[model samples]
Structure formats: structure tokens, C-alpha cells
Target: MTESPVLMSVDDRGIATATLNRPALGNAYNGEMLDALIEGIPRLAADPAIRGLVIRGAGKHFQAGADIHWLSAAAAAPPEQAFASSLQTTRAMQLLNEFPKPSFAVIHGACFGGGTGIACCVDVALATTQASFGITEVRVGVAPTPISTHMVHAMGLRHARRYAITGERFGPEEAMRIGLVHEVHAPEAVEARLEEIVAAMLLSSPAAIAVTKTSLLESNGLALSAHQVTQLTNESWMVRAGKEGKEGLAAFREKRKPAWA
Candidate 1:
């Protein structure tokens, strides 16, 4: 039997951890991974015993983003399916970003593309000194509509525009400097720091945390409407179905510069 692409557990302290489990692929997301996240996050959130969430990647990497072959296939799917694929990506980020409980990410290794999105959505993010980050969707010829708002919210417009468009890989310090992550430490110390943060979070009231997060997002206009979600999903699906997306995915798979480049 195939192993699950995502694994989740909650501790006695009500701290939930979601492990992205596609280690051979750097925990890159495919349809199954996305589906797992879409299902798992809410289930954890609804559990009264669950006080907070921590996201981690199994094996060597936190997350490397979408599996290119799966993404290429998605770009080739029927229009409705293509749209649904985009929706899955969008919804996963939304659910995590809007999670009532405090959310955190412990990032190491490659945190690229949607991995960066996960870092951005979390209330607090910590990374190992060796971790690397990039917002590289454009490099593969697809726009990052799904994570766009979260990127801006986390890192601000000036930083987001530069990195998201350039697809430059940055180390953990740079990620911290740009506000993508809150702290950077040697791999040995990162987990200890995360535990400290989670412990502090548990001292606070869960209901207060939820209200504060919701009010902050809504007051800042970070809360997305259903129509806005549709716009993001539609734009993502349309672009992935377009010529540039096709060419980009092909070029990435072929290990060459895209035609436009």
C-alpha cells in the first residue's frame, strides 16, 4: 500500500502538528497532498482539545512547492478540473491563514513556491540556518494568485513584488529579514525555539487568540470574500491553461530556459 502524502497528530497539550510527507520529492505537493491538507487542517481546528497547529515537513525539506509533473498534468486537465485544482491550493492556504487557533511553521531545507506560502500564512515561522526560500511560481510560468495576498500580508508589498517576481532563492536570514519567517537558528536550536513559542501560546486564551486574529485580518482587509476567492481561482486556472503555463511547465521538465527567457 502507498504511504499517505501528509501525516497529522495532536499532542496531549493540544498542539497539533501536520507533517508534509512526500520526502522523496522534498515534500512537494500533489493532488493527494493538497487534499490531505484541505481535510486535515479543519478537522484539527474543530477539535476543542487542539490549541494550536505546527506545520513541518518530513525528512529533509519543509516543502518544495508543487510537484512539477503533477502541475503539468493539472495544466492539461479539463477546465473544470483545472479550476478545482487551483481552488484546492487556494483553499488550503485560506484555511490555514484563517485558522482560529494559532498556527506556526517550523521550516528547514527548501521552502519554495507554495512552501513560502505556508510560511507566510502561519502566525509565527521559524527556520533553520540552512533552509532556503523562494517564491518561484513565475519561473515555472504560473502566477501565484492563491498565495498573493498572504505574501503581501506577511512580507509587505515592496518585498513580495521583488522576490515573487524574480524567483530568487534566499537563505533563512533573508527570509527573516523580509518577514517571511520570524526567527532563524541553527537546526539544533530551531525546534527548541518553536516549543518555547508554542508553550507561550498555550498560556493565552484560545478564544482571545481567535478573536484577535480575526479582527486583525478583517480590519486590515486581509479577509477574502467568496467572490475574491473565485477571482483568484479563476485567474490561476486560466493562466495554468494558457500558453505560457504550458511552455513553462514543459521547459522546467525539459531542464531548459523557457522560450520567453
Candidate 2:
């Protein structure tokens, strides 16, 4: 069998760890990884024995968001396929956002684009002091449509608009200040802090926690209509297939400033 793009394990204590496994590319999200997350998150949500979840990344980075190569391929796909491809990251974020159990994330290094969405979706987002974050789609002339709602939810519309439009990368301190991350730790203290959170959560009433999460999400979360989904999908594809999008991708691949700049 082929190696899975995302790796998952359930510990003896019923804590499930879903790891973004493509370290060689900064744990970038590609089609396979998105599929893995879309399939894995809901499956984990449905498992009765699972207590909680910890989303993390392998190697140096947590996630650099959508793979640039995947973005290029998606840009070239048929309109129908491109729309579906654009929505996969959104779906995966939704699944984890509405997960019935407690969700946590351990972020380090680059948490860019869709990666920031994953952090926003979790109940508790922790990052090392050295971690960096950005919405960043504008840098490639692509809209941050899929991650927009979550970004707003995490950081508020004002900050979201500022970062989303500027494509500026900020440090973990800014991430925490903007409420995208709950805690920041020194590199060596991250694991201990994670365990502390996990243990505290394990002591809570699991049923009560589930109900609370469901209630909160239903009351104050992103609820998109069919038309809205289509609009966002179209927005993503439009930028990905547009002249600027092509120029941006080519510039990224060539390691140069885009033509517009």
C-alpha cells in the first residue's frame, strides 16, 4: 500500500493524533493530504472510544497550507474539478471545527494559508514561540476564500482583513494576540503544555463537553448556504485560473517577484 499522506494514531488513553505527514515539503497540503483530512476527521469524530484529538505536523513545520504545486494543478483542472478541489480544504476545516470531541493543535514553524484555518477550527491552539503565521493567499493572487470564515472566527474581521489583504507573516505572539492561538510556549515546554491541556480536558465530562461544543458551534459558527459555497468556490477558482494567478504561480515556481510587482 502507498504511504498515507496523513498519519493517525489512537493512544491508550483514547487521544487521537492526526499528523500532517509531508515534512519534506513543509507539511504542505496536496490533494491526497486534503482527502486524508476530509476522510479522517469525520471518521475520528464518529468513533465512540475516542476522547479527544491533537492535530500536529511532522518535521519542522506544522503546515504551509495548500501545496503550490497542487494549486498549479488545480488551476489547470476543469472548472467542475477545480471547484471540488477548492472546497476540500474547507470541508476538512469544517469537520474538525465541528468535531464532537475536544480538539487541539500543536503548531510550529510555518502555519500559512489553510494551516491557519486548521488552527482556528480547534478548541485549543498552541504554538511554539518560534512559529509564524499568515493568511497569505494574496501573495499568489489567489483568494483566501476557503479559510476566510475560520480566519475571521479566530482573529476577528479587522485583523483578518488586515492580514488577509496584506499577506504579511506574523510571529506566534501576534497570532496569540489576535486570538488565533490560545497559548505560546518555549520550544522545550510545548509537549508538557500539550499534556497539561489534554489531562485537564480528560477530566471534564465528555458528554457535557460534546453538547457544549455543539451548542456553541450552532450558535456562533460559520454556516454557509449553497450559493455561498458556490460563490467561494468560484472565487477560489477564478483567482487560481486568472492571469494574475498564472503569473503568481510562475513567479513562485521560478523564485522571483510576480510580474505585477
Q: Report lDDT per candidate.
A: 0.93, 0.89
Runs of candidate 1 with Cα error greater than 4 angstroms are none
Q: What is candidate 1's lDDT per residue for 20-96, written digit by digit as tens?
A: 99999999998899999899988988888999998999999999999999889989999999999999999999999
**Which residue ranges in model 2 land beyond 4 Å of their true spot?**
none
Among these predicted structures, which one has the highest TM-score? 1
Clash pairs detected, candidate 1? none
Weakest ten-residue segment in model 1 by summed lDDT: 3-12
Candidate 2 — worst ten consecutive residues by lDDT sum?
Answer: 220-229
Tens-place lDDT digits, model 2, residues 67-184: 9999999888888888889888767777787898999999999999989989988999999998999888889888988878878888999999999999999999999999999999
**The CA-based lDDT of model 2 is what?**
0.89
lDDT, residue 49, candidate 1: 93
* Residue 81 miss distance in model 1 (angstroms): 0.9
TM-score of each: 0.98, 0.96
